[model samples]
Target: MKKLITALSVFAFLGFAGAAHAAEASGRIAMADPGTSTLTLEDGTTFEVVEGVPLDGLAPGTEVTVSYEEQDGKNVATSIAPAQ
Candidate 1:
């Protein structure tokens, strides 16, 4: 019963952890440094580009929407697309 309770606790924690990062942002790119895989938005938000998200189209003044999560106290983008 103790093992079962521990397993349930872990699962519950995982479920709620995902909800904490369910957020998105839309703004123009203020700075994009491919060397560091980092971007700064016009609103003064800084984010690190996650693997598999293309950066070729990102440039200063480009409008974009970003799906991101706060991991290790840093904003890491999961997806990026042109703002419609």
Candidate 2:
């Protein structure tokens, strides 16, 4: 019973740790490349846009907020929207 509890606790902690890596960034678009499905901010932070996240109307100098997760040393964007 104790070993099972410990294993469950470890799995829960690992799951939360992965969730903790999700983050958001607000900045002006420095570059938006549909061919590569990537967006780069003015600060040089680049994010890889996941499939199904529309990039329409996004362009250089447009302010946007990016929701992303750090995966395998790259920022994988889950969503992007214009900044209010």
lDDT per residue as tens, model 2, 57-80: 797999999999988889999999
Question: What range of 10 consecutive residues in model 1 has the weakest lDDT sum?
Answer: 15-24
Tell me the spans in candidate 1 whose CA falls farther than 4 Å from its real position: 1-16
Top candidate when judged by lDDT against the true structure? 2
CA lDDT of each prediction against the hidden true structure? 0.88, 0.92
**How does model 1 score by TM-score?**
0.76
Candidate 1: RMSD over Cα atoms? Answer: 2.8
Which segments of candidate 2 are over 4 A away from where they belong?
1-20
Q: Write the per-residue lDDT of candidate 1 for residues 1-84, one digit (tens) a residue.
A: 999999999999999877656479999999988778888899999999987777776779999999998888889998888999
